[model samples]
Target: MDLSCFKAYDLRGRVPDQLNPVLAEKIGRAYVEITGAKKVIVGYDIRLSSPDIAEALSSGLMAAGADVFDIGLCGTEQVYFATSHYKMDGGIMVTASHNPKDHNGMKMVGPESRPISSDNGLNEIRDRVLEPFGDAPQQGRYEPLEVMSAYVDHLLGYIDAGSLSPLTIVCNAGNGGAGLVIDELEQHLPFEFVKVHHQPDGHFPNGVPNPILPENRAATADAVIAEGAAMGIAWDGDYDRCFFFDENGRFIEGYYIVGLLADQFLRKTGGGKVIHDPRLTWNTMDLVKAAGGEAIESKTGHAFIKQRMRDEDAVYGGEMSAHHYFRDFAYCDSGMIPWLLVAERLCQSGQTLSSLIDARIEAYPASGEINRTIDDPPKVIAAIEAKYSVGAKSVSHVDGVSIEFDDWRFNLRMSNTEPVVRLNVESRADIPLMEEKTEELLAEMQRLNEER
Candidate 1:
């Protein structure tokens, strides 16, 4: 059996060939056997193959003597919510989350909604799938769980609705499951929503809902401008990550959003730790300190940020890739909570989104994440580091090689899944200097790659 669908963080691959009902059922049984989970929460996205695959997974779980609590047609966070909120033993979300339409996958979490990735039980579950399975002494039952009301209530608890005044907001779901959630939250808020691509369609009429791609951002930006709204928001297929657009119909880099969210969340917490990814730092660090909060950097990725949050008991955590995690929400990332907080901030501050973000951009000019394909990433990185670290104030490798000078700093790291090396450079209130260093770094990297 082809188990190539199994990945380092989660499972994702072409459907039917690498993943299907047969493999899903085996994976489900293996999950139960490995975890000894008695009660499990199951949810799926709006993909065409999701329901059938979820059904088969549940059958195998029941066969292994684990009762299933099915939360149908929801985002990945809903599974995390139901599992931890209701005290389920574990949860599984059948979603390919912004992958190509023809692909499918699953993300699993153990007790307390802690991720079950390759470092823990995911690999064991994959290995167990190939072994034989026997029926349990007693079969387990299945029940459809209603979680939207409780989940939505939890989301609302994160912000001060009393402070929120009337404003026009644009939300583009890109024909993904985010629309279902927006519709549910709409009745309780004062904002007038300008819905674009609002319907939940497996066909993805507007294409896959990945807003990080430049091409996918136009719908939300155009809608915000066309409706004359305060701001715009977009989400990926499972609605676990959300991107932002300012009132002027300009896409805001996720790096800036991280700083904004950290400041906002710190105000509510009165002073707490904020975990952030290491790829970009100066802006977030400045804002976090001014807000009377400590900013801690963690290795990029959901699992690493979440584990660090749990360890530090941080109030909030954010990544430049649009993933935001909340301490109140089982240390799990949410697409809904971040936007709600931003909306509240707008109402209280009474300033346009651009004004709020522009000041930060001026204070800290940044080269948003840039990727380059390198023949030998390690060799090129080493050469760059030897040449660049001579007069640098400090150099560290939390996730990648980050070198800091008095006026500027840059990080160069290789992608875990691809042959591309990612770079991010920033300066203290000097856009021209930031741009110059960015160009110089790229040129040096290209020359080094040629040598390699």
Candidate 2:
């Protein structure tokens, strides 16, 4: 087994070279051993190699004396739903999730759809896979189940069907697993869906399913304007993260969406705790506080966020990367629920998406996360800290280095999954100052790179 395939949160690597059937089988056996799970659920995405990997994983699980339920052709979140909904012991979703075409991986969860990160049980499974183990004396059973209708029902439970307006929504699935769920949910709703790249194409003819990149965003934005739709939504490859665009076809930043969703959740629950990542803070803090809720900051990453939400008894949690977690939804992030809640907000408020977010965006102009590749990430980070920490209002290292001043602030952190440093800058309703400070930080990073 190639150890590099195991990541901080999940398993992801190039096909055959790093991840394949044999290693997947080993992972399956190791997971059963570590969790001591008697029953497990397995699922796959639209990737070309997903079915084979899922089959291998199921075989290994069955060989380990664990009953396996195969839920075919589903998104990552669907596995989460099935694991918790069916009261299964554990689950795994075969997906690369917004990675390039030639890559594949797995997202694992324990009972109740709780995450299995490196800190909890991922590293143990990784180590066990490297050792030798024989099959059990007797094999377990395998069963097939259909979860689409039930999954759609669970999704619709988040919002009232009668309250939704008859608005046209542009849905760009990016040829991933999201189209199937969207189509299923459309039958139960009153809204008109203008589908784009709706088919599940493993080859990704349109492009990779990641809408966070500017190159992949144009199709969704263009479709929204051309269709004269109320709003546009796009999802990643496995559809665990969803992005939104306004009626004017402008791509709304996920930072403001976090605030918006936090506010909505607070309103629904009256008063509760909301968890947010440390990258961008002011907007979420302001919104949560104003809504009579407590705001908690956790380190970035899904594992950390979910754990913090559980610990704090938070009603909702959100990351600037468009991952939203809910207490009602097993404390797991859902790509499907955020848009539905947003749609409900629009319908009940009788306001366009732009109008709803305009004030928040204006009040806190931000530079959506900028990434830079440097030879020495630590040195550059240290340099940034040393330079900016003098006479600063405060400095914190919860996830990375975040420095604050009176009106402007920025957070610089190394990427957990990629080899780049992410920088995010924001100011109090000052776009010019945000741009200037962003450029200044970039120049400093460049200088440090040159010195290296």
Candidate 3:
């Protein structure tokens, strides 16, 4: 039995060979046995193999004496929402979440939608899959649960709907599941949605919905320009993370969005803690401070951010990777809430999206996360840290080494699942300085790599 599909955070692998209905059923039973979850929320994405896999998984849950509340064909966050909102014991979302169309996986959460990563119960569940299993004495029941109406209302609650005036907004679903959500929210909002690639198709005609890549962004950017939309939004296959494009068709880096959202959320709450990743900081720190909100830095990754959000009782948390967590939403990340809040801000302030972001870009110029394939990441990173930390004002390793000077800073961190190192450099209102440092750092990393 190949259990390679089980990952550090979730399950992700090619279908049938690595993950199939049989293993899914076993995983479901294992999940029930491990967590003792009597009631479970089961949901799946728009992948071709999702329905069959979800069905098998539900069977396993029932066999293990867990009643399955099937939320059928929704985003990963929906599972998170259902599990926490309805007080379910746990939830499982069958999705690879922007992985290749041929691949499939699952994202699991325990009570209160707290992530069940390797540090928690995911690894134990994986190990238990190999053990034998028999049906419980009393079989559990299955019910088709419809929570979309309530879910949509919950999403709308995050913003002032009356303040949201008419604006042309471009939404490119990329043939993923976000369109279903946009359609549901459309009736209640005042924005004119210019829908592009708006449909649920597991075939992924416009390629996988990951807008993180430069190549994957043109469709949304072009649509924004062609339609003269106020702003454009794009989501991954599962719609858990959303990317933004300004009114001028320029893709806004997720770092800036973090700052913008922090400011917006702080205004509503009066003052609260905002959890942010360490990779990029100056901009978010500035915004949070101005908003009268306490800025707290957490190590990058959903599990870390979510846990910290829970610990600090933070009102909101964001990663430069585009995951935004909300306290009201059980500390889970939501792709939909961020956009709505941004739109409401635009409506109230009567400011264009590009104009709002341009000021921040000028205030803090950053080298958007640059990745380099280093033969030895640790050695390269350590050498870089040693050389740079000499005259630096401060050096912190909350996630990876982040060295800061009086007016400039840079974070050097290695990818969790790859042999590549990601570098981000920023300067206080100086693009040339930021660019020069970025080049200097990359060249130094190359030199360090070659020395060994």
Candidate 4:
């Protein structure tokens, strides 16, 4: 019931303090009241605290006159899939998602896996959770279902693996729930993949499973080189965002992967629309356009991108944050799809990960995304816009501040869930220039913030 758990995008905080059984019960009641949903699906990750939280949450949902369908031991994406697949009125995922073990949270989706963040009802949920109601509501029944096998089969339905050739790859599940899926899927897969941290260890003794952190990426890169594998892939705690390592043990940027996945999906869909975040490379734009598809840009967040995808009827969407969504998957983001497509691409083209990326590296040089902590985000953004906004070029205030030039572009924006400013810069095949411009803009951002 604590207000601190009401985040910008989702409800998240420490287990006992900000999130607990009492709080979950209130949110469940509030969710049903808000959505008028009669049936709700729920799932959790491999964290030790997840099961308890799920049970508490289920109690709350049932108390609110909602039937709770518990999909035992699954990832966040699985909840999204179940919400759409089972025609449930809504779904909730009890996962902190790459956070440390002490943390726990809930991600809710409306019917069709539509997100419910602060703008959509998180604030109202928080208010209702804190408000003292006289008595607990009537309880409904509970049912258990096994949706993992069916979800996997549904994913594999989109692409054929029979045409794939043999290749050695390394996979690191980072001791999250993804280990369970990898263990099952790898058994029938045709590729030679060396699995690491394939067991579900809630402690995550090695490290948090986030692939964005440079420290976390090292293990996957090292495993790829040590095993002499063609490529490496790692998943976050809930397996929603996938990160990749090349054959030479080099970590690839998520921006590039966006373009790669956009290309792959467009290939099969035959020129359908593709959606991408504004922060990343124009390479995705070019790739989508070149494939005879329309490219749409949206703010950098799963909720926003998914909504945009559904509105545009886009076939696929990818964000620099590593979340990829498919129209077939109810426009919800998945950490599982990127790696599967990467594996298929490797097999079909008979090329290494580096080679596949290398072919496009020349056309899409990038400085990688950078983050800066600041107090006055608006002033900093306004200063950058005043200085950088040119007459002929385009400038947009979609999510944050985005400016497009003839040969280069950059997006400087504040994080939706954090207090930091994020800057993503990319240029036309010029790494040095990209780095220089990135530094220049970052310096200006800092200077303006300091002045204010």
Candidate 5:
């Protein structure tokens, strides 16, 4: 197996060349051996190669003396749900998420849907896969498990269906795996949905299914305005992350959604702990604190966030990248729950999505996240840290280098999945200051890149 296929958090690489059925089977056997999980759940997305990879993985698991429950043709979160919902020993989803069509991978979880990251156990699995190992003493069993009905019921349990209004919602699945869940959930709710790119096409006829990129967002936004919908939502290929847009067809930054969802969850539970990534902080911190909830700062990435949420027993955790984690969901990130909770909030509060987030947007004006490709990310980061640390009121390395002064702050970090450096800047209700600082940082990064 190519070591590059193993990422910091999950397995993702170009298909066939780096990740395929042969390697996937090896990974499956290695996972069972490393974790000693007896009963495992397996699922796949709409990717053309997913079914084959999932089948190979299950075969390997069964060969390793583990009972395999196949939950065929589902999203990544469904595997997470089934793992904990059925009390399975472990689970694996054969998905490449929003990666390009030529790429594929897997997301693995241990008991209770807890993530299997490099820091936890992925490295051990990697090493074991590379070494030689014989088959188990006895072959295990394989069975099919239907989890759609139960999954839908659990999603509706997050919000009162009676509280939702007869509002029109625009849902763009990006021709990924999200359409299946959306179609199922629509039957249990009263919202009028305008579906765009709704079919599950492994070819991704619409695009790569990543709504974070500006090029991939127009469909959802246009549909929201064209259909006069209350709000618009879009998800990645595997449907583990969802993005939101307002009724006016304006794409809302995921940072404000974090604050909105944090406030709602805090209010719903009467007060609890909330976890947020360091990339964007002020708004989440302020909203969480105001709701009488303890706000905890965690490193970015789903694995780190989920572990921190479990450690803090946090009611909710959100990353500006559109991943939302719930304590009740076994500390796993769910793309479905965030929209449901937000829709319920809009209904109960009798406010448009715009109004609900406008105040927070003004209060903590921010530059949503800016990514810059540089020759040497470390050198640029060091330069930024050295240039700003002197006058900064405080500095933190929880995930990246975050420096703050009285009125403004920014977090600069290199991307784990890409060669770009990401910068997020925010200020106390000053849009101009935020913009100025963002430009200043970009200029410095560009200068460093030229020097390199």
Candidate 6:
């Protein structure tokens, strides 16, 4: 068995080559050994390879003397919800998220929906896969279950529209698993919305259905504008993250959405605490602090943010990547929550999405996260630190490397799963300085790449 399936956040790779039935079986045995659990709930997305991978994973789990409750055809979060909702001993979701259709991945959740990344038990699983393990455990069995409806119901529990007013929204499912959730939710929720490419086409005919790309957003934005919808919401393959389009079909950056969600949660929870990734906004921190809540900044990535939330007991957490976590939802990010909150806010205020975000952009202008190809990310980071460390109020190596000045700051870091350096620069109304500093950083990264 090969170990290439092990990735930064989850077990992911191209199907049948890097990730095959044999490797998945070994992973199941290893996961059971690591967790010492007897019962596991398994789920999968609507990918062409998902069902086969799900079967292989179940075989491994059952081989390890674990009873596998196979919850067919679901998203990663549904598995998370199942782990706690049904009191399952553990769970696994087979998905590659927004990756190409050829790619597939697995995300695991321990009891109570605790995530297990490579740092936790994925490495051990990888090791076991490399060296095929001991005899299969005894009494392993398989059971089938359907939890999609239950999962949708659980999501709706957080958003009740009894006294809510309605408006038009354009929902773009991107031909991913989100279509199922949106389809069900629309049946119960009274809202006039246009849906584009809501079918679950495993091939992802329209270019992987990822909302992050301008090309992928075109259909959704066009639908929103053509239908005269209030706003547009587009989700990634698994619906783990969501992006928005304003009434004018302009794509609203995720950073502002994070701040908006933070504001909403802070208002409701009376401002306990909110956490955000450093990649995008200090405006989130400002909003959290302004709401009389404490703001905690953590590194990018869902695992890092979730861990920080657990440590801080934060009421909410968000990232510029569009992942929004909630305290009520076990501190895990949900693509579903943001839309509900947005709808509720719109109903309550009778304001459009653009109107709500106008003041936020003015207050905390951002450069948006920029990525550059680099050979030696560490060397580039060192060079940037050496050049800009002067008069730096403070420095943190938390995620990548972040340096702060009195009025502005920047975070330059390498991608954990790729060969590139990510740069995010923000300032106190100094767009020119931000651009200049960004240029300096990009030049350094290019210089380092050439040197390498």
* Per-candidate local distance difference test: 0.94, 0.93, 0.95, 0.85, 0.92, 0.84
Model 1 C-alpha lDDT per residue in residues 1-452, reported as the tens digit of each score: 99999998999989899999999999989999999999999999999999999999999999999999999999999999999999999999999999999899999999999999999999999999999999999998999999999999999999898999999999988888999989999999999999999998988888988998999998899889899999999999999999999999999999999999999999999999999998889999999999999999999889999999999999999999899999999999999999999999999999999999999999988999999999998999999999999999999899879999999999999886667999999999999999999999999999988882
Model 3 misplaced stretches (Cα beyond 4 Å) = none
- Tens digit of per-residue lDDT, candidate 5, span 327-377: 999999899999999999989999999998899888999998998888888
Q: Which stretches of candidate 2 lie above 4 Å from their native place?
A: none
The candidate 4 region of ten consecutive residues with least summed lDDT is: 130-139
TM-score of each: 0.99, 0.98, 0.99, 0.96, 0.97, 0.95
How far out, in Å, is residue 334 in model 6? 1.2
Model 2 agreement with the true structure over 1-452: per-residue lDDT tens digits: 57788998999999999999999999999999999998999999999999999999999899888999999999988899999999999999999999898999999999999999898999999999999989988898999989888888899988877888899999999999999998888888888999999999999999989999989888989999999999999999899999999999999999999999999888889999999998999999999999999999899999999999989999999999999999988899999999999999999899999998999988889999999998999999999999999999999999889999999999999999889999999999998999999999999999999993
Error of 4 at 102 (Å): 0.4
> Which runs in model 4 stand beyond 4 Å of their true positions?
134-138
In model 1, where do residues sit more than 4 Å from their true spots? Answer: none
Q: Say which prediction, candidate 2 or candidate 6, comes out ahead on lDDT.
A: 2
Q: Please give the distance, in angstroms, between residue 273's alpha carbon in candidate 1 and its true position after superposition.
A: 0.5
Candidate with the larger TM-score of 5 and 6: 5
Each prediction's total of clashing residue pairs, residues at least 3 apart in sequence or on different chains, is 0, 0, 0, 1, 0, 1
Better of 3 and 6 by TM-score: 3
Task: Show the colliding residue pairs in model 4.
Answer: 240-335
Model 1 TM-score relative to the real fold? 0.99
